[model samples]
Target: MEPIIIDGTAKTPTVKFDSTTGVMEIKGRSIPENSIEFYKPMVDWLDEYAKSSKDQTVVNVQLEYFNTSSSKCILDVFKKLEAINKGGSKVLINWYYEEDDEDMLEAGEDYESIIRVPFKMIEIVE
Candidate 1:
């Protein structure tokens, strides 16, 4: 399956979803004007990927910040991945946050609680 690669902009994050390697990445700020619109493709892509997903899927999310709207959309993305995990494939979410950014860490923990999949909270120095 072809990957979904979206360059980050002032209002969005960089998205790199490579099905071949079962590795997906979302980084940068995610405060898009239309959060739902921006994330729909990702959710859709996950839908397609689920059909023939890899044995292990790893998603790396490193966001500096995100708005309330973007937060829900972000959860939607995680929910999709959770489904993939429930389908028997191992799914790991590596959530990266700045060492001093407690809010970001809590945000990741929130998603970890909501989603059934396992999550690794990675603290980035500096």
Candidate 2:
């Protein structure tokens, strides 16, 4: 599958999905006008990748802020990962947050509690 790379904008985060190196990362702020539109292809690609994936899938997410709609999109991403995990593929999620951002850390913990996949919360000391 082709990589998904979107340049970061004021209200939208960058998405980089590199199938070659087995590293998929999403970083930056997220508050897009149309959250579903921005995340549709990404979800589709992930769905496709999950079908034929042999290597472990690692998703790294680092965001400064996101809107409510973006939160839904993120949950969708995790749901996809959960499906992949149930399909017998190894899935790992690393949620990176600033040291003092307890809100983000709590959000990560919430996701970790709900999702069956392996989710790791990482502190990024700035």
Local distance difference test scores for all models: 0.95, 0.88
By summed lDDT, the worst window of 10 consecutive residues in model 1 runs over 29-38
lDDT of 2 by residue, 1-126 (tens): 788999999999999987666578889999987799888888898898787865688889999998889989989988988998888578899999999999999989988998898988999986
On residues 52-77, what C-alpha lDDT tens digit does candidate 1 reach at each position? 99999999999998999999999999
| Worst 10-residue lDDT window, candidate 2 | 17-26
Name the lDDT value of residue 39 in candidate 2: 86
TM-score of 1: 0.98
Candidate 1's C-alpha lDDT? 0.95
Task: For candidate 2, list the clashing residue pairs, or say none.
Answer: none
* Model 2 quality (TM-score): 0.94
- Evaluate residue 109 in candidate 1 and report its C-alpha lDDT on the 0 to 100 scale: 94
Report lDDT (Cα) of residue 112, candidate 1.
90
Per-residue error for 75 in candidate 2, Å, reads 0.5
Error of 1 at 100 (Å): 0.5
